[model samples]
Target: MKAKKIERKVSIALLFSITLLCCGGGQSLLAQANPAVFQIFEKYSKQKKVTLLEVSEELMAEYRIKQFKSIIFEDGTLALPEIRRCIEQDKQDAKKLKEATADGLVVSGYYRLKTVDPAMNRYLIFKVGKKNKVTLLYIEGRLTPEELVELLK
Candidate 1:
Protein backbone atom coordinates (compact mmCIF):
# COMPACT_ATOMS: atom_id res chain seq x y z
CA MET A 1 0.00 0.00 0.00
CA LYS A 2 2.78 2.40 0.87
CA ALA A 3 4.52 1.59 -2.36
CA LYS A 4 1.37 2.34 -4.30
CA LYS A 5 1.01 5.69 -2.61
CA ILE A 6 4.57 6.62 -3.41
CA GLU A 7 4.07 5.65 -7.01
CA ARG A 8 0.93 7.72 -7.20
CA LYS A 9 2.67 10.76 -5.81
CA VAL A 10 5.48 10.56 -8.34
CA SER A 11 2.98 10.41 -11.15
CA ILE A 12 1.16 13.50 -9.93
CA ALA A 13 4.36 15.43 -9.55
CA LEU A 14 5.42 14.69 -13.10
CA LEU A 15 2.01 15.68 -14.41
CA PHE A 16 2.11 18.91 -12.49
CA SER A 17 5.55 19.69 -13.82
CA ILE A 18 4.46 19.01 -17.37
CA THR A 19 1.36 21.14 -16.96
CA LEU A 20 3.48 24.02 -15.73
CA LEU A 21 5.54 24.04 -18.91
CA CYS A 22 3.17 22.64 -21.50
CA CYS A 23 -0.19 24.26 -20.76
CA GLY A 24 0.79 27.84 -20.03
CA GLY A 25 0.66 28.57 -23.73
CA GLY A 26 -2.41 30.36 -25.08
CA GLN A 27 -4.97 27.74 -24.12
CA SER A 28 -3.40 24.55 -25.32
CA LEU A 29 -6.50 22.38 -25.12
CA LEU A 30 -4.29 19.50 -26.10
CA ALA A 31 -3.76 18.80 -22.45
CA GLN A 32 -7.48 18.56 -21.89
CA ALA A 33 -7.77 16.03 -24.64
CA ASN A 34 -4.92 14.04 -23.15
CA PRO A 35 -6.44 13.85 -19.71
CA ALA A 36 -5.72 10.17 -19.54
CA VAL A 37 -2.03 11.07 -19.64
CA PHE A 38 -2.47 13.58 -16.84
CA GLN A 39 -4.64 11.29 -14.77
CA ILE A 40 -2.26 8.45 -15.19
CA PHE A 41 0.72 10.63 -14.30
CA GLU A 42 -1.20 12.10 -11.38
CA LYS A 43 -2.07 8.68 -10.05
CA TYR A 44 1.34 7.09 -10.28
CA SER A 45 4.11 9.42 -9.13
CA LYS A 46 5.38 12.77 -7.94
CA GLN A 47 5.83 15.74 -10.28
CA LYS A 48 9.47 16.33 -10.96
CA LYS A 49 11.49 18.54 -13.28
CA VAL A 50 14.46 16.38 -13.96
CA THR A 51 17.33 17.54 -16.16
CA LEU A 52 16.63 16.14 -19.59
CA LEU A 53 19.56 13.96 -20.56
CA GLU A 54 18.64 12.77 -24.03
CA VAL A 55 15.75 11.41 -26.07
CA SER A 56 15.17 9.29 -29.12
CA GLU A 57 12.27 8.16 -31.27
CA GLU A 58 12.66 4.70 -29.83
CA LEU A 59 12.52 6.13 -26.35
CA MET A 60 9.22 7.80 -27.11
CA ALA A 61 7.55 4.50 -27.75
CA GLU A 62 9.02 3.09 -24.55
CA TYR A 63 7.93 6.20 -22.73
CA ARG A 64 4.38 5.69 -23.92
CA ILE A 65 4.50 2.13 -22.69
CA LYS A 66 5.90 3.22 -19.34
CA GLN A 67 3.17 5.78 -18.80
CA PHE A 68 0.59 3.15 -19.60
CA LYS A 69 2.23 0.80 -17.12
CA SER A 70 2.05 3.41 -14.40
CA ILE A 71 -1.60 3.95 -15.11
CA ILE A 72 -2.38 0.26 -15.16
CA PHE A 73 -0.58 -0.33 -11.89
CA GLU A 74 -2.63 2.32 -10.14
CA ASP A 75 -5.89 0.82 -11.36
CA GLY A 76 -5.10 -2.39 -9.49
CA THR A 77 -7.25 -4.18 -11.99
CA LEU A 78 -5.14 -4.22 -15.12
CA ALA A 79 -1.83 -5.98 -15.41
CA LEU A 80 1.09 -4.84 -17.57
CA PRO A 81 0.29 -7.53 -20.08
CA GLU A 82 -3.27 -6.32 -20.25
CA ILE A 83 -2.06 -2.80 -20.85
CA ARG A 84 0.24 -4.06 -23.59
CA ARG A 85 -2.74 -5.77 -25.13
CA CYS A 86 -4.62 -2.49 -25.14
CA ILE A 87 -1.69 -0.72 -26.82
CA GLU A 88 -1.50 -3.42 -29.44
CA GLN A 89 -5.16 -2.96 -30.11
CA ASP A 90 -4.63 0.73 -30.85
CA LYS A 91 -3.02 0.31 -34.22
CA GLN A 92 -3.76 3.84 -35.21
CA ASP A 93 -2.31 5.31 -32.02
CA ALA A 94 0.82 3.23 -32.36
CA LYS A 95 1.23 4.33 -35.93
CA LYS A 96 0.87 7.94 -34.96
CA LEU A 97 3.51 7.66 -32.29
CA LYS A 98 5.90 6.02 -34.69
CA GLU A 99 5.31 8.60 -37.37
CA ALA A 100 5.71 11.49 -34.97
CA THR A 101 9.03 10.26 -33.69
CA ALA A 102 10.30 9.91 -37.19
CA ASP A 103 9.64 13.53 -38.04
CA GLY A 104 9.98 15.96 -35.13
CA LEU A 105 11.62 13.90 -32.45
CA VAL A 106 15.17 15.11 -31.97
CA VAL A 107 17.76 12.40 -31.80
CA SER A 108 19.62 13.50 -28.65
CA GLY A 109 16.52 15.39 -27.66
CA TYR A 110 16.17 19.19 -27.49
CA TYR A 111 18.01 21.07 -24.78
CA ARG A 112 16.27 23.34 -22.30
CA LEU A 113 18.26 25.87 -20.30
CA LYS A 114 17.01 26.00 -16.76
CA THR A 115 18.05 27.90 -13.66
CA VAL A 116 20.14 31.07 -13.48
CA ASP A 117 23.64 32.04 -12.38
CA PRO A 118 25.54 29.08 -13.70
CA ALA A 119 22.49 27.85 -15.53
CA MET A 120 21.65 24.18 -15.57
CA ASN A 121 20.89 22.55 -18.89
CA ARG A 122 17.94 20.25 -19.32
CA TYR A 123 17.01 18.33 -22.43
CA LEU A 124 13.42 18.56 -23.61
CA ILE A 125 12.39 15.91 -26.06
CA PHE A 126 9.40 15.28 -28.32
CA LYS A 127 7.99 12.66 -30.59
CA VAL A 128 6.50 13.50 -33.96
CA GLY A 129 3.20 11.94 -34.85
CA LYS A 130 2.85 12.60 -38.53
CA LYS A 131 3.19 16.20 -37.32
CA ASN A 132 5.37 18.53 -35.27
CA LYS A 133 4.22 19.15 -31.71
CA VAL A 134 7.57 19.52 -30.00
CA THR A 135 7.40 23.18 -29.27
CA LEU A 136 4.06 23.07 -27.49
CA LEU A 137 5.13 26.12 -25.53
CA TYR A 138 7.94 28.61 -25.36
CA ILE A 139 10.49 26.73 -23.35
CA GLU A 140 12.81 28.92 -21.37
CA GLY A 141 16.46 28.85 -22.37
CA ARG A 142 17.38 25.45 -23.76
CA LEU A 143 15.24 22.37 -23.27
CA THR A 144 16.71 19.62 -21.14
CA PRO A 145 16.06 15.92 -21.23
CA GLU A 146 13.37 16.32 -18.61
CA GLU A 147 11.75 19.13 -20.52
CA LEU A 148 11.94 17.15 -23.72
CA VAL A 149 10.15 14.36 -21.93
CA GLU A 150 7.41 16.79 -20.86
CA LEU A 151 5.14 15.77 -23.70
CA LEU A 152 5.49 12.12 -23.00
CA LYS A 153 3.81 12.10 -19.60
Candidate 2:
Protein backbone atom coordinates (compact mmCIF):
# COMPACT_ATOMS: atom_id res chain seq x y z
CA MET A 1 0.00 0.00 0.00
CA LYS A 2 1.10 3.55 -0.72
CA ALA A 3 0.52 6.50 1.62
CA LYS A 4 -1.07 9.39 -0.22
CA LYS A 5 0.81 12.67 0.27
CA ILE A 6 -0.37 16.19 -0.41
CA GLU A 7 1.79 19.23 -1.25
CA ARG A 8 -0.17 21.22 1.32
CA LYS A 9 -2.98 20.66 3.83
CA VAL A 10 -6.08 22.12 2.25
CA SER A 11 -9.40 22.94 3.96
CA ILE A 12 -12.43 20.81 3.20
CA ALA A 13 -15.90 22.19 4.05
CA LEU A 14 -19.22 20.28 4.24
CA LEU A 15 -17.38 17.34 2.75
CA PHE A 16 -18.77 14.02 3.99
CA SER A 17 -16.08 11.75 2.62
CA ILE A 18 -16.88 9.02 5.10
CA THR A 19 -20.59 8.92 4.33
CA LEU A 20 -19.90 8.94 0.63
CA LEU A 21 -17.29 6.26 1.14
CA CYS A 22 -19.99 4.11 2.70
CA CYS A 23 -23.00 5.41 0.80
CA GLY A 24 -21.25 6.53 -2.39
CA GLY A 25 -21.15 9.97 -4.07
CA GLY A 26 -22.32 12.09 -7.09
CA GLN A 27 -25.56 12.95 -5.24
CA SER A 28 -24.60 15.69 -2.78
CA LEU A 29 -24.90 18.24 -5.55
CA LEU A 30 -28.64 17.55 -5.56
CA ALA A 31 -28.93 17.56 -1.76
CA GLN A 32 -27.19 20.88 -1.09
CA ALA A 33 -29.14 22.34 -3.97
CA ASN A 34 -32.47 20.84 -2.93
CA PRO A 35 -32.58 20.43 0.82
CA ALA A 36 -36.27 20.01 1.66
CA VAL A 37 -36.67 16.91 -0.54
CA PHE A 38 -33.21 15.89 -1.70
CA GLN A 39 -32.75 13.30 1.04
CA ILE A 40 -31.20 10.02 -0.09
CA PHE A 41 -32.75 6.62 0.65
CA GLU A 42 -30.83 3.42 1.29
CA LYS A 43 -31.05 0.23 -0.73
CA TYR A 44 -34.58 -1.29 -0.80
CA SER A 45 -35.88 1.51 1.43
CA LYS A 46 -39.58 2.32 1.72
CA GLN A 47 -41.15 5.68 0.90
CA LYS A 48 -44.28 7.63 1.88
CA LYS A 49 -46.08 10.61 0.43
CA VAL A 50 -46.90 13.41 2.80
CA THR A 51 -50.10 14.22 0.96
CA LEU A 52 -51.23 10.78 -0.15
CA LEU A 53 -51.57 9.97 3.56
CA GLU A 54 -51.18 6.26 2.89
CA VAL A 55 -48.36 3.77 3.23
CA SER A 56 -47.48 1.58 0.28
CA GLU A 57 -48.14 -2.12 0.89
CA GLU A 58 -44.56 -3.15 0.20
CA LEU A 59 -43.18 -0.39 2.45
CA MET A 60 -45.78 -1.14 5.11
CA ALA A 61 -44.44 -4.65 5.40
CA GLU A 62 -41.00 -3.30 6.25
CA TYR A 63 -42.42 -0.61 8.57
CA ARG A 64 -39.70 1.85 7.74
CA ILE A 65 -39.44 5.35 6.33
CA LYS A 66 -36.47 5.89 4.09
CA GLN A 67 -35.64 8.95 2.00
CA PHE A 68 -37.18 8.10 -1.34
CA LYS A 69 -39.69 10.01 -3.46
CA SER A 70 -42.38 7.86 -4.99
CA ILE A 71 -42.18 7.88 -8.73
CA ILE A 72 -44.71 10.28 -10.25
CA PHE A 73 -45.40 10.87 -13.90
CA GLU A 74 -47.65 12.73 -16.27
CA ASP A 75 -51.37 12.25 -15.47
CA GLY A 76 -50.44 11.96 -11.77
CA THR A 77 -49.76 8.30 -12.28
CA LEU A 78 -47.29 6.45 -10.06
CA ALA A 79 -45.32 4.15 -12.27
CA LEU A 80 -41.71 3.05 -11.89
CA PRO A 81 -40.95 3.45 -15.57
CA GLU A 82 -42.47 6.92 -15.81
CA ILE A 83 -40.73 7.92 -12.63
CA ARG A 84 -37.42 6.83 -14.10
CA ARG A 85 -38.12 8.83 -17.23
CA CYS A 86 -38.82 11.94 -15.19
CA ILE A 87 -35.65 11.45 -13.15
CA GLU A 88 -33.52 10.98 -16.23
CA GLN A 89 -35.12 13.85 -18.12
CA ASP A 90 -34.84 16.15 -15.11
CA LYS A 91 -31.05 16.21 -15.35
CA GLN A 92 -31.60 19.33 -17.43
CA ASP A 93 -30.74 22.83 -16.22
CA ALA A 94 -31.23 22.43 -12.48
CA LYS A 95 -32.14 26.07 -11.93
CA LYS A 96 -34.66 26.28 -14.74
CA LEU A 97 -36.12 22.97 -13.58
CA LYS A 98 -36.36 24.09 -9.95
CA GLU A 99 -39.13 26.52 -10.91
CA ALA A 100 -41.02 23.80 -9.05
CA THR A 101 -39.66 20.34 -9.79
CA ALA A 102 -38.34 19.19 -13.10
CA ASP A 103 -38.99 15.69 -11.86
CA GLY A 104 -42.50 16.50 -10.67
CA LEU A 105 -45.59 14.48 -11.54
CA VAL A 106 -47.43 15.84 -14.54
CA VAL A 107 -51.14 15.21 -14.92
CA SER A 108 -52.59 15.22 -18.36
CA GLY A 109 -55.38 17.74 -19.08
CA TYR A 110 -54.09 19.69 -16.08
CA TYR A 111 -51.03 21.61 -14.80
CA ARG A 112 -47.94 21.22 -12.63
CA LEU A 113 -47.20 22.80 -9.26
CA LYS A 114 -43.91 24.61 -9.35
CA THR A 115 -42.25 26.71 -6.64
CA VAL A 116 -44.49 28.61 -4.30
CA ASP A 117 -43.26 32.13 -3.56
CA PRO A 118 -45.22 33.02 -0.44
CA ALA A 119 -43.26 36.17 0.21
CA MET A 120 -44.90 38.17 -2.55
CA ASN A 121 -47.85 35.91 -1.99
CA ARG A 122 -47.14 34.49 -5.41
CA TYR A 123 -46.70 30.82 -6.29
CA LEU A 124 -46.28 29.22 -9.71
CA ILE A 125 -47.83 26.05 -11.07
CA PHE A 126 -48.22 25.14 -14.70
CA LYS A 127 -50.14 22.77 -16.94
CA VAL A 128 -49.45 21.67 -20.50
CA GLY A 129 -52.53 22.15 -22.61
CA LYS A 130 -53.55 19.77 -25.36
CA LYS A 131 -52.33 22.20 -27.97
CA ASN A 132 -48.66 22.11 -28.93
CA LYS A 133 -46.38 23.54 -26.19
CA VAL A 134 -49.32 25.33 -24.58
CA THR A 135 -49.21 25.72 -20.79
CA LEU A 136 -51.07 27.33 -17.91
CA LEU A 137 -49.28 29.02 -14.96
CA TYR A 138 -50.84 29.16 -11.56
CA ILE A 139 -49.89 31.87 -9.08
CA GLU A 140 -52.33 30.84 -6.41
CA GLY A 141 -52.98 27.59 -4.56
CA ARG A 142 -55.52 25.31 -6.15
CA LEU A 143 -54.31 21.70 -5.91
CA THR A 144 -53.40 20.05 -2.65
CA PRO A 145 -51.97 16.57 -2.17
CA GLU A 146 -55.45 15.31 -1.48
CA GLU A 147 -56.57 17.15 -4.57
CA LEU A 148 -53.95 15.29 -6.58
CA VAL A 149 -55.90 12.06 -6.33
CA GLU A 150 -59.15 13.75 -7.21
CA LEU A 151 -57.60 15.66 -10.07
CA LEU A 152 -56.59 12.40 -11.65
CA LYS A 153 -60.17 11.17 -11.45
Candidate 3:
Protein backbone atom coordinates (compact mmCIF):
# COMPACT_ATOMS: atom_id res chain seq x y z
CA MET A 1 0.00 0.00 0.00
CA LYS A 2 2.85 2.40 0.83
CA ALA A 3 4.58 1.75 -2.53
CA LYS A 4 1.31 2.23 -4.41
CA LYS A 5 0.69 5.58 -2.71
CA ILE A 6 4.21 6.78 -3.51
CA GLU A 7 3.76 5.89 -7.20
CA ARG A 8 0.46 7.76 -7.34
CA LYS A 9 2.07 10.83 -5.80
CA VAL A 10 4.88 10.76 -8.36
CA SER A 11 2.44 10.45 -11.22
CA ILE A 12 0.45 13.41 -9.99
CA ALA A 13 3.60 15.51 -9.65
CA LEU A 14 4.64 14.66 -13.22
CA LEU A 15 1.23 15.61 -14.56
CA PHE A 16 1.31 18.95 -12.74
CA SER A 17 4.75 19.72 -14.09
CA ILE A 18 3.67 18.96 -17.65
CA THR A 19 0.63 21.17 -17.31
CA LEU A 20 2.72 24.09 -16.11
CA LEU A 21 5.22 23.68 -18.90
CA CYS A 22 2.52 23.63 -21.56
CA CYS A 23 0.77 26.68 -20.17
CA GLY A 24 3.97 28.69 -19.93
CA GLY A 25 5.02 27.72 -23.45
CA GLY A 26 1.66 28.79 -24.87
CA GLN A 27 1.84 32.21 -23.23
CA SER A 28 5.36 32.78 -24.51
CA LEU A 29 4.31 31.87 -28.03
CA LEU A 30 1.46 34.36 -27.92
CA ALA A 31 3.79 37.11 -26.77
CA GLN A 32 6.34 36.29 -29.43
CA ALA A 33 3.67 36.25 -32.12
CA ASN A 34 2.95 39.94 -31.49
CA PRO A 35 6.26 41.37 -30.44
CA ALA A 36 5.62 44.62 -32.30
CA VAL A 37 2.42 45.28 -30.42
CA PHE A 38 4.02 44.39 -27.13
CA GLN A 39 6.99 46.60 -27.84
CA ILE A 40 4.72 49.53 -28.65
CA PHE A 41 2.85 49.01 -25.40
CA GLU A 42 6.10 49.02 -23.52
CA LYS A 43 7.17 52.26 -25.18
CA TYR A 44 3.82 53.84 -24.46
CA SER A 45 4.06 52.91 -20.81
CA LYS A 46 7.39 54.72 -20.66
CA GLN A 47 5.83 57.83 -22.26
CA LYS A 48 8.27 57.72 -25.12
CA LYS A 49 7.63 58.96 -28.61
CA VAL A 50 8.08 56.05 -31.00
CA THR A 51 8.51 56.70 -34.67
CA LEU A 52 7.26 53.96 -36.95
CA LEU A 53 10.27 54.15 -39.20
CA GLU A 54 12.54 53.68 -36.21
CA VAL A 55 11.07 50.31 -35.30
CA SER A 56 12.81 47.17 -36.46
CA GLU A 57 11.71 45.67 -39.77
CA GLU A 58 11.24 42.27 -38.16
CA LEU A 59 8.96 43.70 -35.50
CA MET A 60 7.09 45.87 -37.99
CA ALA A 61 6.65 42.99 -40.40
CA GLU A 62 5.04 40.94 -37.65
CA TYR A 63 2.21 43.50 -37.42
CA ARG A 64 2.18 44.27 -41.15
CA ILE A 65 3.07 47.86 -40.23
CA LYS A 66 5.82 49.02 -42.49
CA GLN A 67 6.13 52.39 -40.78
CA PHE A 68 4.81 53.67 -37.47
CA LYS A 69 4.80 56.93 -35.50
CA SER A 70 3.45 57.26 -31.99
CA ILE A 71 2.80 60.19 -29.63
CA ILE A 72 1.60 60.21 -26.04
CA PHE A 73 -0.10 62.93 -24.06
CA GLU A 74 2.48 64.75 -22.00
CA ASP A 75 0.29 67.58 -20.74
CA GLY A 76 -2.71 65.26 -20.37
CA THR A 77 -4.77 67.11 -22.98
CA LEU A 78 -5.18 67.66 -26.70
CA ALA A 79 -7.07 70.24 -28.67
CA LEU A 80 -10.30 69.25 -30.42
CA PRO A 81 -9.18 70.88 -33.64
CA GLU A 82 -6.08 68.71 -33.76
CA ILE A 83 -8.20 65.63 -33.39
CA ARG A 84 -10.51 66.94 -36.08
CA ARG A 85 -7.59 67.54 -38.38
CA CYS A 86 -6.50 63.96 -37.99
CA ILE A 87 -9.99 62.84 -38.94
CA GLU A 88 -10.18 65.18 -41.90
CA GLN A 89 -6.93 64.34 -43.65
CA ASP A 90 -7.38 62.51 -46.97
CA LYS A 91 -11.11 62.86 -46.38
CA GLN A 92 -11.10 59.19 -45.48
CA ASP A 93 -13.94 57.90 -43.39
CA ALA A 94 -12.92 57.40 -39.80
CA LYS A 95 -14.21 54.38 -37.94
CA LYS A 96 -15.19 54.90 -34.34
CA LEU A 97 -13.70 52.23 -32.10
CA LYS A 98 -15.27 53.85 -29.06
CA GLU A 99 -18.25 56.13 -28.67
CA ALA A 100 -17.76 59.92 -28.46
CA THR A 101 -19.61 61.82 -25.83
CA ALA A 102 -18.71 64.43 -23.25
CA ASP A 103 -15.90 62.01 -22.50
CA GLY A 104 -13.79 61.37 -25.62
CA LEU A 105 -13.35 59.49 -28.88
CA VAL A 106 -11.32 56.58 -30.22
CA VAL A 107 -11.09 56.77 -33.99
CA SER A 108 -9.00 55.15 -36.69
CA GLY A 109 -8.67 55.48 -40.45
CA TYR A 110 -6.31 55.08 -43.38
CA TYR A 111 -5.42 56.94 -46.53
CA ARG A 112 -3.08 56.40 -49.42
CA LEU A 113 -0.98 59.09 -51.00
CA LYS A 114 -0.73 59.42 -54.76
CA THR A 115 2.52 57.53 -55.08
CA VAL A 116 3.63 54.89 -57.52
CA ASP A 117 3.75 52.32 -54.74
CA PRO A 118 0.65 53.84 -53.10
CA ALA A 119 1.43 52.76 -49.57
CA MET A 120 -1.55 53.07 -47.23
CA ASN A 121 -1.06 55.29 -44.19
CA ARG A 122 -3.19 54.43 -41.17
CA TYR A 123 -3.85 56.47 -38.05
CA LEU A 124 -5.35 55.69 -34.67
CA ILE A 125 -6.45 58.63 -32.49
CA PHE A 126 -7.42 58.12 -28.89
CA LYS A 127 -8.49 60.82 -26.44
CA VAL A 128 -9.52 60.16 -22.88
CA GLY A 129 -12.17 62.48 -21.45
CA LYS A 130 -11.53 66.09 -20.47
CA LYS A 131 -8.17 65.16 -19.04
CA ASN A 132 -6.68 65.99 -22.44
CA LYS A 133 -4.83 62.68 -22.45
CA VAL A 134 -4.35 61.37 -25.98
CA THR A 135 -2.30 58.99 -28.07
CA LEU A 136 -1.96 59.12 -31.82
CA LEU A 137 -0.35 56.38 -33.85
CA TYR A 138 0.40 56.60 -37.54
CA ILE A 139 1.24 53.46 -39.47
CA GLU A 140 2.18 53.19 -43.10
CA GLY A 141 1.99 49.64 -44.40
CA ARG A 142 0.67 47.17 -46.93
CA LEU A 143 -2.27 45.97 -44.88
CA THR A 144 -5.74 47.13 -45.83
CA PRO A 145 -7.41 49.73 -43.62
CA GLU A 146 -9.82 47.15 -42.27
CA GLU A 147 -7.00 44.77 -41.42
CA LEU A 148 -5.12 47.55 -39.68
CA VAL A 149 -8.16 48.45 -37.68
CA GLU A 150 -8.61 44.83 -36.65
CA LEU A 151 -4.99 44.63 -35.62
CA LEU A 152 -5.27 47.78 -33.54
CA LYS A 153 -8.47 46.52 -31.93
**Predicted candidate 2 versus true structure: per-residue lDDT over 1-153, tens digit per residue:** 123233222223224555565445534333323321122112112434312122333553332222223222133223333333433343332223233333464422222223333221111223332322222222223334344435335
Span of ten consecutive residues with least summed lDDT in model 1: 129-138
User: The CA-based lDDT of model 1 is what?
Assistant: 0.32
TM-score of each: 0.20, 0.18, 0.42
lDDT of each: 0.32, 0.30, 0.50
Ranking by lDDT: 3, 1, 2
lDDT of 2: 0.30
Residue pairs with backbone atoms closer than 3 Å in model 2 (clashes): 75-106, 75-107, 111-127, 112-126
Error of 2 at 34 (Å): 20
Name the top lDDT candidate: 3
Considering summed lDDT, which 10 consecutive residues are worst modelled in model 3? 29-38
Error of 2 at 141 (Å): 2.7
Candidate 2: worst-modelled 10 consecutive residues by lDDT: 35-44
- In Å, residue 88's CA in model 3 sits off its true spot by 3.7
Report how far residue 109 has shifted in candidate 3, in Å.
6.9
